[model samples]
Target: MATRAELTEIFGAEGVISLPRSEATAAGLSEDDARVLCDVGFPAELPVIFSLDVPGDPSAFSLVPVDTGADITKVLCLGGPSGNSEMRYCLDMEDGYVILLTLGRQPAAEIINSTVDAFVEFLYRYGLRLKHIASADDRQADEYTKQLRQYLAERDPQAFAEEDTWWNMIFDRLLGKEF
Candidate 1:
């Protein structure tokens, strides 16, 4: 698992900011989780945020508050909106597993990765996917996919498979397939 310092090195100071401990505490995060959040902070920008109803409206993406008061057990909102939002990402407080909460879909909270480290890796891979989709040339995309596969395999093989499956489902849904 990558440490906070390692993540900072990977993401850079501009990309990753340390969250205030007070804010993390107020958000009801556990000590270790709070440390992780406080250390690496949240992603400055999520590369992907597409609305199901409106595809081109940039206003569709916004951060939603993670309600710790909600009835769901042992889950913390990592980023993104809830309710009307098509997808919301979360973390399982108990084990640091990352989960995807898809609204209006069966089996709502899909476990995407086994740990926060793996989850961060997933974010990096997802960003690559977005870039690949946008770029005209396939060379960069192929290289990125190759590197990401190696990173995931080295970090956690199981998470590599799970993230690939989850991203496939997510991409399918984004492309107009019903969840």
Candidate 2:
């Protein structure tokens, strides 16, 4: 569950902003999808590692929309870097899966989590782990990274189902920079 208090704690009170139901509906979102966006809303502007930014509008659903093979509206782009080939975070309304539309001509959209709640939780968890990483030893850092990866996989196996997922890319970058 992505309760208000939990989100506030993760992305300060000022940072959190609920997605508008009207915008979601206008974007061809389902009732359940609209409800989820309105209820567990995300930060309209997040510049963190697990980031999804909609600076122009408040949690706007209007951006570079993509067709994820299935249908023209299967993947709904929330926000990210501009352009069609840029990194865009999206939502698979019907499946309730959060997508990290990566850059490349290949399969651009990859599942970030099975649900938006898990995605929020992952962002919170990753941030916490990053804050405390400096205090940990080399061995501790490796263990913590492994634990976080395992936790994320357990939370949503579909997100980590592929070897070259967005989650894997994040972990790889983390290793390259930190460990």
Candidate 3:
């Protein structure tokens, strides 16, 4: 298990950006749209925009699946108008893949957030850990960890309350290195 700081280092600063609603809409999606059309549920979508500039007109739905060798699953969703444009939102994990919804003017925020929630639920159902991400700065990492803890608490109060061991485990696996 890696600490939050370690995870942050591996993921890089780009990994911690808040998901942008404007980008989601620009990718033929609406504002505040969220749902899951693929493999599994995911964590809450934090606003993060990834720059994927290239040449020519490359417009298509791309799903990237990376195996992080963790108990949890992960996925990233990327789409845009041109080849040089960046991804509206990306979900990264080791568990499953993001769904490509080919529709007109979908809500990026809703879609991204809902899909992530679904995946997070999926991980909990399987008693698995969710993908861990962190910020490079210590203060940022601490804030992110606190937010994650709050999210976990709100999502699974009982599970969170009953386990001192799980907290230690999660802390170790998600934000351990910094401590």
Number of the top-ranking candidate, with TM-score as the measure: 2
Supply candidate 2's per-residue lDDT for 133: 78
Which candidate leads the pack in lDDT? Answer: 2
Model 1's lDDT to the true fold?
0.55
lDDT of each model, Cα atoms only?
Answer: 0.55, 0.66, 0.36
- The digit string of per-residue lDDT tens for model 2 on 82-108 reads 333356677777687877766556646
Worst 10 residues of 1 by lDDT: 50-59
**Against the true structure, what is each candidate's TM-score?**
0.60, 0.74, 0.27
| CA RMSD per model (angstroms) | 6.8, 4.1, 14.5
Q: Which stretches of candidate 2 lie over 4 Å from their true place?
A: 44-48, 54-60, 63-65, 68-70, 81-85, 102-107, 177-179
**What is the total number of backbone clashes in candidate 3?**
33
lDDT of model number 3: 0.36
What candidate 1 gets wrong by more than 4 Å, as runs, is 1-18, 49-72, 81-84, 105-107, 125-137, 162-164, 168-179
The candidate with the higher TM-score, 1 or 3, is 1
Instruction: Identify the superior model by lDDT, candidate 1 or candidate 2.
Output: 2
Give RMSD (Å) of candidate 2 vs. truth. 4.1
